[model samples]
Target: MPDETTDTTAVAEQRIAALAAAHPWVSEARLTPDGVLLVTPHPRATAALPTPGPLVGEHLAHWEEVYEWTYETAEGRHAGDLDLSGWRASDTGEPLPTAHMRDWVDRTVGLVLAQGPNRLLELGCGTGLLAHRLAPRLEGYVGTDVAAVAVDRLSGAGLPRAAFVRAAAHETETPPVRQAMEQVFGAGVRPDCVLLNSVTQCFPDLAYLSAFLHSALTVVEDGGTVIVGDIRHAGLLEDHFGRVERARDPEAADADIAARVASAVAEDRELSFAPAAVQRILAAHSRTVRMSVHARTMAYDSELTRYRYDLVLHVGPAPGTAAVSETRQLPWPGRGSEPLAVLLRKALSAGPVVLHGIPNALLTDAPDAVTPHDLRQALTGTDAAVLLDAGDPRMLAVAAPADRATAATARSLRAPVGRLAHEPLPAFVQRRLPEVLRDHLRRTQPGTVLPRIVVDDAPKGAVR
Candidate 1:
């Protein structure tokens, strides 16, 4: 038998060909867009991504042990196993019920809304910590995890508004999740918000996040929000090392920082992130999103200042508008403000705006039109749409409903565009309108600086 891991590229390809031949429906077997077969620049970074446990079995004996690890019903207390926090603070110190943990949970709940979203589904529902807390907020809430022990415990406690289920990672066992979701809500029910709070850290790689995100897109209803909550940036991990050293050695608060981090590298749980990684992935789908930065809060009696800053993201627009981007990773092309762009921003502030009848060529390009890749990149996060007319002049209009208002907002951007605007916006925008036309709209307009972000207004939505 051929060893699967040791197979050469030619051998792997030949096997794929044979497998395709045996399957009649196999149109073609292919690699991913990023060429998974071609390169893995940082394999070790995502190697230990979490999987199902508590454990994966059909027998009763395993569950009995799962129960033993977590609960001492005799003592009426929670314990080891199935709880994410079990190993997290094991070496830190005894629990004094820190305020930081509570703050984290409360801040997380705030994202679903202060007063809306009738239904919510949370993936990787670790111990239902957030689930139990959120029961009173929404009409229906579903929390799912692979650990049957945790599910069994939460289900037994019986929160009225929430239900817990045993389900594997969304990638490996998507059907089970869909089924469990149906069982909890009903056959045709869909959640308004899908939460992955502090969860993606466990995944094997960005590839897993990508697969699960696509799965989420299929499962979530249109205009429904997908909250990819509490993810790390490359900088967060660096900040953490300093905090860890401080915690471990109070006297050496000013110790050689680099050396301390090097010594603790293998002994500690290191974080991993790819720069602007999640944004790049979401860009491909064109889903509107708002990202905010979250830092860890501390309890009164806590002995540590842990390194953590949760990035909260809100995906899917209120009704219209989808977020786009300049590059796979960058949100904006850094083309600063243009006349029309500024005018549109003001119009949006007061209410929705519609451009007067203009040439359709500006959109679909009749002849000298707007189709360049760089041109498209400049228009990344606008909330406007193109009007399709059979023969009449085409127009561009904001996509929000008739009564649109500038509600709460979240925005993120790296570069300042005020200086860049001097370069001038492409002639396509100017072509849509005559140069002498701006005096009328500028009367009521207040200058507002728009940042280039996928979307805005959430926990981390205002991130720079």
Candidate 2:
């Protein structure tokens, strides 16, 4: 008898090809000999790909629809598992290293615990990644999200002392924070710590973030903590896209990379903030709130470590509460003069260091741009910590738009080899491919363009 599996696969491929042929977005779909399916977009459809600029009133709805589809389609798989929460992968569909994810969680939880909060309220707690890990240690935990499916699933988990509610990041009044407060803590109580981990990027703009911060401060008890973690650095936006473009086509000319980076920057929809911007917003809200920015201590030097940092605000803290050891300010020796590895190594050995106003390496045609990997290697076996902070806002210059048109958005198609035959191409693409693409790109692209900071480090374990 002929193999049944081969016959089934052939049928599935035929059906998939037919579906792709009918889909307006797809020009062609074919299975490789290795069973990977490749779908090319229709040439005319490329122009119509969404040009997402500043998302004004519709950002909340956009994210809700995005995550609702995420949890709804990923229901059957063990998507609820802590490890799978905010799952990441490369453009080629290979999962990125999980060590960095673990580092982020561990460090964030450490920051929360350091706050010594009795009860914790996390905004945008998609899949309860932190809540699940944090609930047992806290007196109470409340997780909020825009996706009802995420809320429902996390609610069903029965995690002790933890409650899941459906609410947008900017809207704390809805679903009534007081109601959750009564259920989690005692009546007429409030959580001491409010966390928005990996949540700020989804915000439509700084205005939305400021509003959320203001609302969060009103509910959080005096002297409480508000942790804004995984904030995209506005300064390194272009350098970030430059790195991605370089990786995509290593042999591409500098002009091509610059053009692509400009196009990507223009279309980016995520909200990135300068540390200075955060400082300004919080200062405007209340001077009593002390804030400090810290760099990621993850061992790996991926986009997260390179282009993102965390902000911790101490609500109503005493004066000098946020003070750190005097940081030795070092003017960044431009990229062409001294190797960054040498500069950083010397700086850390002397004491805690901070370098301001560095030029962006990707902006110039310097091929030997010192990467985070080089900085990490320089710091190996030392007590010092190293990180790149956002640079002066004036140094960043915008590139002219790319002449070539590219897809405005990537459709996420989820299919296990031949299994997508029954699913519509548009649905599958929206359901599968774009989520990964967004997550991957979200870290790499800044929502806004700002200056670039080359190196910022603190010694004696101050930053770590």
Whose TM-score is greatest here? Answer: 2
Which sections of candidate 2 miss by over 4 Å? 1-55, 75-80, 83-86, 89-93, 319-464
Top-lDDT candidate index: 2
Provide the RMSD of all predictions against the true structure, rounded to 1 decimal: 22.3, 18.1
Least accurate 10 contiguous residues by lDDT in model 2: 403-412
Q: Which ten residues in a row have the lowest lDDT in candidate 1?
A: 455-464
TM-score of 1: 0.50
Q: How many clashing residue pairs are found in candidate 2?
A: 7
Q: CA lDDT, every prediction?
A: 0.42, 0.57
Q: After superposition, how far is residue 397 of candidate 1 from its true place, in Å?
A: 29
Clashes of each: 9, 7
The residue-by-residue lDDT of candidate 1 on 1-464, one tens digit each, is 98666566445444433433233212233333332211111222122224321111111223335444644332323432123343234336454353455555665676456325677788777666677777667778888776666777788876776777676446423666667667666888887777777655444334446556656655665656666655543333434556557767777745586677655542332223432454455566656654433322223212222322334344456444422221111112222355445544444443343322222222234432321222223333754332211111121122222212111111123321111101011121122121111221233223421111111111111101
